[model samples]
Target: MWVADYLSLLITCQAMSQSDMEGVEQCFLDISVDQVLHYDGVPAVEPWATMYIDAIHDKRFGDAIWARYQIFGDVVDGLIDDGRLTVLESIEEDAVGYKKNAPEAFDEAVAFYKSVTNSADGHPEVIEIIMRIDKEDVSNRYFPEGG
Candidate 1:
């Protein structure tokens, strides 16, 4: 699963008052730190905006994931254009500072998340938002950890 997707799961569980955060955290996920260390004001996820707005119009309780979407939904949508999707292969070369040095930590985090989701059979649909966000390496700092 992607970083934003993982975060959304945590936020969703937190908002729902579910204990999934423990499962997520105990899995040793690390996208949160990678997001903090790599932000550069790029855009974010588009599908999450659509899903969040749709949820807002519905009668559901305030999902922590949705609340996070509320915070960054616009930015997420802006990342996409009418006819294309941005694809981030990985962190850029000459990453300048912290991003240059954080690969091992980030990879460790990603591995844990993979293990957790694999153990679960598969990641849930809610995590797709984070996947979308992470795929672009867009600015995902708005969705905080432990939210």
Candidate 2:
């Protein structure tokens, strides 16, 4: 499933018309993966709060990183309620801090998520995973182990 998603993300980007791919921010599209979660069969599935946090490790997307973290918090909150995945105690602290510092960035993050997930078919799920993993890389910068 993960491989399918990964390939889908790559193929989707490749299939995207030049203008469509160009519309995507080069920074958001940075091709990096969190090595911690990239191992085979990690069961690294949903409520992907950690992945979202990890993505912001890059300073180039400073505010955007914070924004994606915030958005992940919101999604995780809902997922927790829905019995999807347990929220990690460590990230809960950062999520609180992010909410206080960058409320608007969080909003933008949610919009970013919706925009990416609510798209064309084919490799849609792959795109979602890519976004989740990329967002996590950004958030990892705040975590001790992530650095």
Candidate 3:
């Protein structure tokens, strides 16, 4: 799945040693800007984006995170360009620390979810994706291990 693909990239990014600048650059190259920009995966995969952003802020990834951040921006811009407006808006809103306003954020997410599900653009595959994501055990859902 796309989430697994993303997580694999992130895990590879995080595991790179400081001396592996060449490998780091290659990793950056491997993460296609087009793919990130066109990402149409379910909302459950959103945390992987956060994980990438968090890696940027972390000291462990060193300066490679800056390049990752640039790619992330490209992805965001792509989302905007592709008319994934709600996804972009949700990302912006979620950045405000959802834990501090869990109830409100969750309600908003649910409302947003309903809107998406009910939209004319909605499809059976999208609903299936949502149902698959929703059915995962909470532990695996939230803290999935990279394979």
lDDT of each: 0.32, 0.38, 0.37
TM-score-best of 1 and 3? 1
lDDT by residue (77-124, candidate 1, tens digit) is 433222132111111211111122454543443444344342232224
| Global local distance difference test of model 1 | 0.32
Point out where model 2 deviates above 4 Å: 1-87, 111-147
Residue runs of model 1 more than 4 Å from their true location after superposition = 1-71, 75-99, 118-147
TM-score of each predicted structure versus truth = 0.26, 0.24, 0.21
Q: Model 2, range 1-147, lDDT digits (tens) per residue? A: 999999977865564444332212322322223321342323333344243323333222333233333333454543442344333332343443344456455445445656543222323433344334335534433544332
Residue 130 deviation, candidate 3, in Å?
Answer: 2.7
C-alpha RMSD of candidate 1? 14.3
| Better candidate by TM-score, 1 or 2 | 1
Model 2 accuracy (lDDT, Cα): 0.38
